[model samples]
Target: MTEDFYCDEVLSDKIQVRKVLETDNVLAYYHTKPFWPVHVVAIPKKHIPSLITLEESDNELLLELLRVIKKVATMVTEENGACRVITNLGDYQDSKHLHWHIVSGEPLKQLFNERLQ
Candidate 1:
């Protein structure tokens, strides 16, 4: 995958995503490859690399992104009774673009279970 999948693929339209919520500077969509039964990804429309890379200029954008994430998380939690909000960084991040995942239901892979145990 490219370093910035969200910018190079999803945002650029090279890959299509089912959008859950969208504003001028943010987008919440169903993950192209989901890790959980109900997995949604929220990202800033503008490239921000990673959470650690966020600059002071990005404060407003971050707030907007969080707002979208909160809405998506609330929807998932209301339906599923519970959900998780997750983000990865450094080596754990597959895609460098800043993004948050709102997910519900058991993890589809045993790796997550093994790590938790």
Candidate 2:
């Protein structure tokens, strides 16, 4: 995978995702590969690397991203009664792109299998 999966694959449309919400600057979608029973991902339309990498100039973008996250979280909570919004950085981050996960429910055992082919 590339350093910025969101920019390289997701935003590029190389990887198709089920969209939950979308706006001029943000997008919320069902995870391409879900880890939890109810997992949704939200990302900025523009590349921002990671949360810590955000600059003061990105204040508006950050606010927009948060709005999308909040909306997605609310929907998840309404359906599941509970939900969490999370973001990863540094080593914990598999994708270097700035993205947030609004998820609910327990983790799944086997979401997708590896194909030897």
Candidate 3:
């Protein structure tokens, strides 16, 4: 897999995603493999390395992406009562792409199952 899973898979259509919202510059969808009960991912359709890498020229694109994220976040929060918006950075980031996760409820996967035992 590439460092940018979003570009290599999701954007490339190698992995299909169920879309939640879409705009000319943004795409929001249900995570292919959800980590939470209510999990959605919002990303710019165009490939952006990461949030911190965005340049001043990308202001409009950034605004559009944020609008989509806000819409998705509101939907999740209204339906689930609460939600969390998250974005990883640097080494903590699994995929080196500008993506935001709008999630609700406790984790569905036992990601640290082995470590806890």
Which of the numbered candidates is closest to the native, going by highest lDDT? Answer: 1
Alpha-carbon deviation at 50 in model 1, angstroms = 0.6
Which lDDT tens digits does candidate 3 get at residues 24-111?
8898999988999898999898888888999999999999999998999899999989999999889888888899999998887665
Candidate 3 clash pair list: none
Query: Best by TM-score, which number?
Result: 1
Candidate 2 residue lDDT tens string, 1-117? 678888899899998899999999999999988899999999999998899999999999999999989888988999999998999999999888899999897767544343322
lDDT of 2: 0.90
Pairs of colliding residues, candidate 1: none
What's the lDDT of the predicted structure labeled candidate 1? 0.94
Task: Give the clash total for candidate 3.
Answer: 0
- lDDT over C-alpha atoms for residue 81 of model 1: 100
Q: Write the number of the candidate with greater lDDT, choosing between 2 and 3.
A: 2
lDDT of 1 by residue, 1-117 (tens): 679999999999998899999999999999988989999999999999999999999999999999999999999999999999999999999999999999999877865778888
